[model samples]
Target chain A: MTDRSRDGLRPSLDQPRRGFMPRFNIALVLPAQLTMMAVVIVPTLIILWLAITDWQPTQAIPWYDATPVWFWNFYDLWYDERFVNAVGRTLFVVGVCVALELGLALGLALLFLDEWPWRRVAVSIIILPMMIIPVDAANAFFMLFNERGPINHMISLVIGAPFEFSWLSHPTWAMAPIMMAEVWQWTPLMFLLVLTGLMNLPQNQVRAAIVLGASPVRIFFKVMLPLLAPVISIALLIRSIETFKIFDPVYILTRGQPGGSTETISMFMYNGAFVYFRMGYIAAAALLVLVVVISVCLVLARPMTKHS
Target chain B: MDRKLELRALRKSFGDVEAVKGIDLALNRGEFLSLLGPSGCGKSTTLSLIAGFLQPDAGEILVDGKVVNRVSPRKRRIGLVFQDYAVFSKLSVRANLSFGLEAQRVPRLERDRAVAEISEKLNLNPILAARGGELNMSEMQRVALARVLVTKPELLLLDEPMSNLDAALRAKLRGELKQIQKELEQTVLYVTHDQVEALSMSDRIAVMRDGEILQDDSTEAIYRRPAERFVAEFIGDPPINMVTCTVTAEGGVVSVSTALHRNLPLGQGEIAPGQYLLAVRPHHFQASREAAAGTVGSEIRLVENFGAEHVLHVSYGDDLVAVVVAPGFAREGERIHLALHAEQAHLFDLESGQVIALQRREAAA
Candidate 1:
């Protein structure tokens, strides 16, 4: 069999093709490459050009004909207290929300490790938040946080008085609803990831620990938690990146209103670009965010892939 | 602490299938007992019940003379080495060894001393810094064993601990494991399907089939006097050969006859036997190059080689019977005389598969 195959291949390899061989493999991928160039590459180049200029869509001149500001937009952005505050607020949100999501997901995933009746149903219900469209989920939270909504009604019932507090309109509490909406929507995704890791864990390791006379808490922290580290790191990485760019909940719930206390980087960029028509200025902010996110992801992803 | 472990009519079921029917067993301190059976014979389930991992539906598990039916696995103080070793893959070997002691809140100095002792005993001192996932199979096995032994568990359960090892490693580890068990005087409940492991290591073995133990006796007795046909068949290496035969009891003289040999006398029994199975171990049949008195002739059909000995498959009346011989003793298609050692044979009733006892005449006479 080996000789026959080798003999069959010898003639084909020993002689060159008489005519040109059409390169069809490159042609097969051309459509996808062209789509990527049109949708992603073209806009990115446009953004780069606009980032160095003072162009606005409302200006009389076309974008390419606009005057170059030559680093003035970046100079203005560095001292822009609103942008700086937004950056700080977005980081804070990512930290608090990802931590909370991980804690909640881990607790929930542990509850799901052992099967009981209706466990599949319970998981489906728990992960229902992940299945809802982000826009629709943000809208749902908008209604839930309303002064006359069920949340206030439940609070009134608990405290034994008719109380209605304006959650979205309060500057100090406005960010709470937005962050809560983000956590509420994406925690199910984190939960699912953690549950998968838990289900796939080496069961005998846990059994060995159990028989070794480790307490339940010790087994959980020393055995299960260390085993779960890779999964937790990945979940935190994904949730942090997604929460850093949080926009829909802010837009639907408060629109960074109540004196911009709830403004995140995505909300600030949105208002600067489409709302205020400062396309050139927001383009600079977008480019800065892109570079920062990519670098941070590269740093985080290397360790993650290595461990997993 | 009179008995290291005892189970009273232990039973467990999963949904509708009863994995372990009612079982009763006891192990004394320093006793090495093996639960020997084929797969799905409830040996592992029995181990789990004793380890407190699975709750028995209907009976009591006593450790050190106290009922522990309501106890959780952690409080049971049982050490288990699983089939996969389960060596805490994320921890270093030292950490894996020290885990149990630390969990019990042992002092750092004492934990270190205990870890060092077991590591030295198991030859795991060299791999102390290696991660559990990084070590080879034998190292992982040593780590798994050393981890539990450091805890000084009340009882130790090993679920086919050597199944993952190669044959050479298994043979080497078997001797090492037996030595360790003897040195420590640890009360162990070993679960395995391999008869060689059970026979070689166990002080006593309980042969199980279909969720019930057929015979619980000393290792030698279980091999010599099996209570049932399954026990006889499941306890030997080349496996016991079952030959169809007729037994007659007339005037206190009982005789059995088979197609290969006729009218071999067995001492008096009240057994009203017709067709029965004569169970003979492979080594019980003697093979000679020449026909001798009371020897029947058979042709060697195949020779299966083991390093120490070869099991020759010989063609009997209408079936093949394996007889163990020395290496290069016989070749294929060669005629040889085979003798039946009646004193060492067992007769099983055809219908019930239960052994029918009879006083036997000494074959030497």
Candidate 2:
């Protein structure tokens, strides 16, 4: 239609000139490619190679004397009850924290949908927890759950008795405080995303549904929920991934105490690498965690991508 | 004789602005009534109030002689087709059609039958398996209509459903809508700002302005016997020509005089002699070449050819009057004589914008 397109009709004009063009493109991209190789690719390959070798950092043996064990570290991890329990506990925490955050955030978002005085101020206050650093948030909760803290004081007043318990010393009860801290720090993100989805819903369709005799509950489940599927899925996926790698709150609140009961996969990996100095085993375990995370992400992102 | 819906002094306001002032209307059973006005004339507000989407501030809405002012939209058996054709994009066409029936807890077999019947009638059976997001605009509109109609609502409210359509598609859908309404004998309340859609489809039309209904009458009477100058000017395509004149009563006859036309006799009516507006439609004025007695002479300033009819904008002294004539009857800069029939002209009070006197045909003859 135009001169350029007419020129494309000829075979000779379609061939690109052989000059410095290809080399120039390579030159432009070389820096980024080299940076990725040095920073990510080389380190990942070394970690992979080390994972299959039997090497002890504590020994004074040279690196060339290390022998290939061929997945003996991975095979030992399957039978390691502590490692297995740590993985299970991490999944449990992720499930409970994500569920609680999603439920509380959905409730808060729905409440903010209505008009009230000081609504903007209230929303700003609610989002403040998300802005605080995670370590600081964990420390704040750590102080709050102490023996003489306000939480114990409120509990004592409610039950008409002074109730006192060492929250970090108990084995099973230690996880509860860490989970509460995680939920409090992250629910606002879900609220912000879901509220945006709620506000952007097609208003005419809602009005039409009402006029066609759909009750409020029906409208929510049938119309609103289906429309919010993509947002809900994405929010849940992000929350699950972050909650699965939870470590700061556990370290601050419990330090994996009470016979390692509150230890997550991240804590186990950290102990293996730094505290126990099992470098080859930790590398093998880290690769396994990466595979698990990728599988979980793929599973969680399926519904969202399908909808879009 | 059966009154299907009635509104008594319905009123609404958003903050300081009164969206719908006190208004009263009665819709008969099986009659297609339209609320016709320009944008922001409260037509859509009235439709919302009737559909139970908004509660009237201080009035009563009666459906089948029962007050439903406190009823929520879900409880009121009313159907509304919005202007945007709000078809649920996530649902299949069949699912969208059966949404209302599903809400009412109709049995699956019966709901399926109803959906099939309505989809067939609306010619949407071919697209029933497709999702609503995949369909074109016309198909979306049909799905919206069928979704509402399947529930067999008592009263149907449509708010300019064809406003988003192209002209050709709109004309076709207009005929189909009218035909479907007639077949079902449904009590319908249609709202539109386009006068042509209102005039062509409505059994009776109510013209509104500034949140108030100025005139309500049959389509024929609204065109030929507009109650006020605003109604006359608003309803016609070329619009009505209005000239300021002074009325003088002499014995038993009343005559109006303007700067360009003198001593134009109007039929007898009890009108106080004062400044008034003389309104006449373009087609009602007679144009000729020869200067007849009692005719105003003017030179044509411009001529617009519109296939079957031509409109000549003629200038007389400082006033311009548009006269509709047959094609090839006049050219630019040609001298033509124009006369107005006494019965075809309307007189309104200049300040109040109300009809002061309308000449009777028999009396004028």
Candidate 3:
């Protein structure tokens, strides 16, 4: 027993290691793990504590010292029309933007399938939008939709009258510019993904279909589309998630103005935390959004991984 | 004698290189014609041109004498089976088989019946619900065939369909495919580089070389009377043995004298005396264990085992020539006697590579 105790450290080191962490190189992942823990895990824990307490940063006390009001923030969120409207509006934006992006991308990708003299040049031009900074693209859109911008000038030229309609201040029409900007800026990425999938497809299958007398339309839907399912699903998942947190164009063009007609979930949280200084309520809303988005992504990813 | 498909001076070029030289070919209804050649021989290019997948630089393609060069592939109504057996991986076997029928807007009941018939014919019932990608290579081949056969196209084009199959599977599929073609009376244009496939399965063989069809004839005729040295060298299993010899034509009797044999009479023809090549198949050279009165003595250099027969590569005056013999007849390094059947041999011009024809008395009789 005395000898065993003396060799304890050596025996422990020789024992088969347990747990997944021991199998990995901790030094290689130390920086990433530490960053995630500091930025994400710590903030999440703090949010869990702050969610139950009506803590405002404007208060003359530390967040930990605030008095807790358990479940009140969630209760208030349930009846808040603005929060409910923002959630619905965000989903609507995601659906519209992702669908539009997919449809436009698919159409554009089909044109580049066959080789031509200037095909590479055309492809480079088409993907140019994706290379620009998102903030710059949003600013460009804001100016394009301005009251006295070239858009109105073109409309005036077509209609033979001055057509300076204020697109941002309009209640219902303001959402158009934001969605268009999102679609225009990101459709190129979706196009490239879909084009890659199309290019790598089994070429003989298409020729076989051609010899089988399948019409072009029939070939596209039945043969090519099914082959593109995995790529399309991945594109949809990524674009939908990115569109759900849309905020840059909204901030640049309208900032959720015109009676808050276009406030998405991210914009709602930003206003609650930074503008209105409701840190506790925003923390609760953020948690809810995070849970919903994660679950939705999981459900969407299940069938894709299974097929692949 | 209905001409089901025909290509008139079909030509195709890829930049500076011509893939398919101006070539003319025709397939009768219900006939199985094989385009046999080595790789880069433009046999596949001809198939593609006929299928409308590729446009010929200058040529005419006709289905039942109706020019189809301007028609779209989908409208041409031709069926093609690719070398890889390109089965639709995402679809089930049944869906793949019925794809053409559905595309042609055949009613649901007719489509199902056609799919059932083809699947039953191809023995694909067990894997009907299986996905195309899930099936093995042979299964994919069957599905690819069934998918096109269900459409009942006027002409079917198969591009090296058996190249992906194993030897045993290939032998079995060859018999099966020939039987199916005969039973259905389906006109087929099969492409292959394998001479065995061409000889065993084809009713007619078109030997191609370097983007040109050298000979298009009945299988027996192509084997027995190859027009070019390339064709004779390509068609036989042991490959025709080529020997340089001197040809002399005198007294209306054309004969060749080689290093081993003297004055071996070929036939009667009008020809100038010059050096020529004497081509003879391995089977035409008779081998004996002991030297005979007319046989030339040689030593066996190598032995190739081919199950039923053994091919002996015997030394023939500083040259090695293959002679097929029964197994156990000879061993490597053993002394042997070989005699040439002169009438069975061919004579080719030294410069032209063209066969020098001779009218033999026995052949004429």
Error of 3 at B80 (Å): 1.2
Q: What TM-score does each of the candidates earn?
A: 0.93, 0.86, 0.91
lDDT at B269, model 1 = 82
**TM-score of predicted model 2?**
0.86
Measured against the true two-chain complex, the DockQ scores of the candidates, in the order shown, are 0.80, 0.65, 0.69
Best by DockQ: 1
lDDT, residue B305, candidate 1:
96
Best-to-worst TM-score order: 1, 3, 2
The prediction achieving the highest TM-score against the true structure is: 1
Query: How do these models rank on lDDT, best leading?
Result: 3, 1, 2
lDDT of each: 0.91, 0.88, 0.91
lDDT of 3 by residue, B198-312 (tens): 9999999999998999999999989888888899999998999999999888898998889898888899899899899999999999998778877988889999999899999
Clashes of each: 0, 0, 0
Q: What digit string (tens of lDDT, one per residue) describes model 3 on residues A1-308?
A: 55674677444534655676465778779999999999999999999999999999899789999789889999999999999999999889999899999999999999999998999999999999889988889899999999998889899999999899999889999999999999999999999999999999999999999889888898898889989999899998998888888999888888888888988898889899999999999999998899889987998798788975
| Clashing pairs in model 3, backbone N/Cα/C closer than 3 A | none
Candidate 3, residue A252: the lDDT equals 83
- Per-residue alpha-carbon lDDT of candidate 2 for residues A1-308, written as tens digits (9 for 90 to 100): 46766676654545665787789999999999999999999989878987998677887666546678988999999999989999999999999999999999988998998789999999999999999999999999999888788888899999999889888788878898999999999999989989998889888888888888887888888888888888899999999999999998988998777798998999898888888888788889989999999999999999867765
Cα deviation at B206, candidate 3, in Å, is: 1.0
- lDDT by residue (tens digit), candidate 1, A1-308: 56755677554554555545445655888899999999999999999999999899898789999889989999999999999999989889988999999999999999999989999999999999998988999999999989999899999999999989999999899899888989999999999999999998999999898888788799899889988888888887898888888999999999999888989999999999899999999999999888878877787788677874
